[model samples]
Target: MPKKIAAGNWKMNGTRASLPDAMAIAATPAGDCAVVLCPPATLLSQMGTEGLALGGQYCHPNASGTHTGDISAPMLADAGATYCITGHSERRADHGESDADVCAQTEAAWSAGLVAILCIGETLAQREAGETLAVLTAQLNGSLPNGATAENTVIAYEPVWAIGTGKVASPDQVAEVHDALRAQVGPEMSLLYGGSVKAGNAAELFALENVNGGLVGGASLKAADFAPIITALAAS
Candidate 1:
């Protein structure tokens, strides 16, 4: 299996002042698990100096262009991002990003020598309709680029309804999806669980068979909150 990873996605929520949190996270002993922080673009270069793996929240499919306000994968790499998130639920819902767009962007990330942490999940309605597996399979097929390998790609499963909603999928629920995802993506690919993951529930979730680590959001803003999750992954 790929080395376990605990990646924190700061989203649009940090500024230069937030480097202390990154420093604190970097200060924490990581053991065998990898720790990554994806701060906003404004802080990427600054956080890069903190001695932790850095990532970008999003990137454009193109290497460079006059897309205006869009950061390309190469730009992110130049800024010290080793990984870039693609097809996050927020981007899909708010920006209308499609699976094809994610695939292209993933390829761009790989081209730039960055790993792509591709996000896929089911909406509450879709889960209720018993379509979670189908939705995940389709997203996996469409968003993944050709020639993807365990070293260059990671998958994050964040149930749409649970993200920031203070609701976490039960271990059984998480295991169900992760098991299926592992089967689809192959056993070597690192799989992460996202959405409402807190220190309180981190260990239980990490103990699940196919759950390698997490793509943390709100809890990741502080080292105190995020460190435990990292510890849980390392212990797992």
Candidate 2:
């Protein structure tokens, strides 16, 4: 079986005052599931609680140079990050990042000895047009480098329209995409479903055959909410 994980992306949120919440989450009994928290880069080095593996929200494709405010994978690793998210829908949409850009970033994460949580998803328009699977396939093919393996890479499927929108992909919808992802990434690599995953719906989602866990957004900021989700994955 693939390793089950409950990853939280606290994107652009959290401060020194928020460490207590992260600490509280770190203390939760996760059973067999690994709990990861990707706080903002400012909090990455400071948020390393015992049970929670720390991750970075993003990393530049190149190792180092004058990128002017850009961070590199080695920097994230130095900050104690064991993993980094690449190709998140927001990055793709906000920064105009291309599949090639994500591929390079994944490779950069590997070079820094950091696991890359490579994200791939379709917009509402694409999903409505029945291009979800095709979009995911293309993203997977274009964004992953040759050296990717279960150990160094995790895949996350977050429907672009659903992220932070209080909307979620139904069970059959998640299962279909995750099933396709599993076939391509093989059985060992973990596949996560992101986008509006709350405690109320987590267990049902995690129970799916190919969904190893989630790439949680808003729900992750509070331990009260995120802990149950982690417990749920552990039980699943």
Candidate 3:
């Protein structure tokens, strides 16, 4: 299996001043685990210098084009990003991004020599209807490209209701989805759990059999809140 990865998604937050938080995280030792910080586009190049793997929040499927304010995968790579997140629920909900669009973006990330962190999950209504596994299966099949592998891709399962809502999926609930994902994608692919991941719950989450690491949100904004989670993964 690939080494565990603890990735932080700053998501429309951070400025030059906030680079210090990432710098602090980079300064911490992450034994046997890889750490990545995906800040907004403005900080990719600067954050790259902090010695942590750097990533982008999103990338346009096309390599380049006239799409105003859109950054392509190649452009992200050029700007010092080693990874790019796609198919996040926020994008799906806000921009109406479809599964096919995520697949194209994943391909674009691979084409640019960047790892694609593909996000998938079910909404509260879908989960309430006991359709979590079914929803995950469909999203996994539709979003992942044919040539995906451990080296080029990572999967993040972020239950829509839990994200930023202080509601986290129980260990058993997380295990079921992650196990199914492992079965579908094979054991080699790295699978991450996101949504309300914090220091208090990090170790328990990382202890699950199939969970490799995390795709952190609000907690990742500060080194103080994020480092303990990385510490937990390292211990796991």
TM-score for each predicted model, relative to the true structure: 0.98, 0.99, 0.98
C-alpha lDDT score of every prediction, in listed order:
0.92, 0.95, 0.93
Q: Which stretches of candidate 2 lie over 4 Å from their true place?
A: none
The sequence of per-residue lDDT tens digits that candidate 1 reaches over residues 1-236 is: 77699999999898778888899999887788889999998888888654589999899988887899999888999989999999999999999999998999899999999999999999999999999999999999999988999999999999999999999999999999999988888889999999999999999999998999999999999999999998888888
| Backbone clashes in model 1, listed as residue pairs | none
User: Which 10-residue window of candidate 1 scores lowest in summed lDDT?
Assistant: 42-51
Model 3, span 73-177: residue lDDT tens:
998999999999999999999999999999999999999999999999999999999999999999988999999999999999999999999999999999999
Candidate 2: the clashing residue pairs are none
Candidate with best lDDT: 2
How do the residues 88-168 of candidate 2 rate in per-residue lDDT, one tens digit apiece?
Answer: 999999999999999999999999999999999999999999999999999999999997899999999999999999999
Better of 2 and 3 by lDDT: 2
Q: In terms of TM-score, how similar is model 1 to the real structure?
A: 0.98
Residue 85 in model 1: lDDT: 94
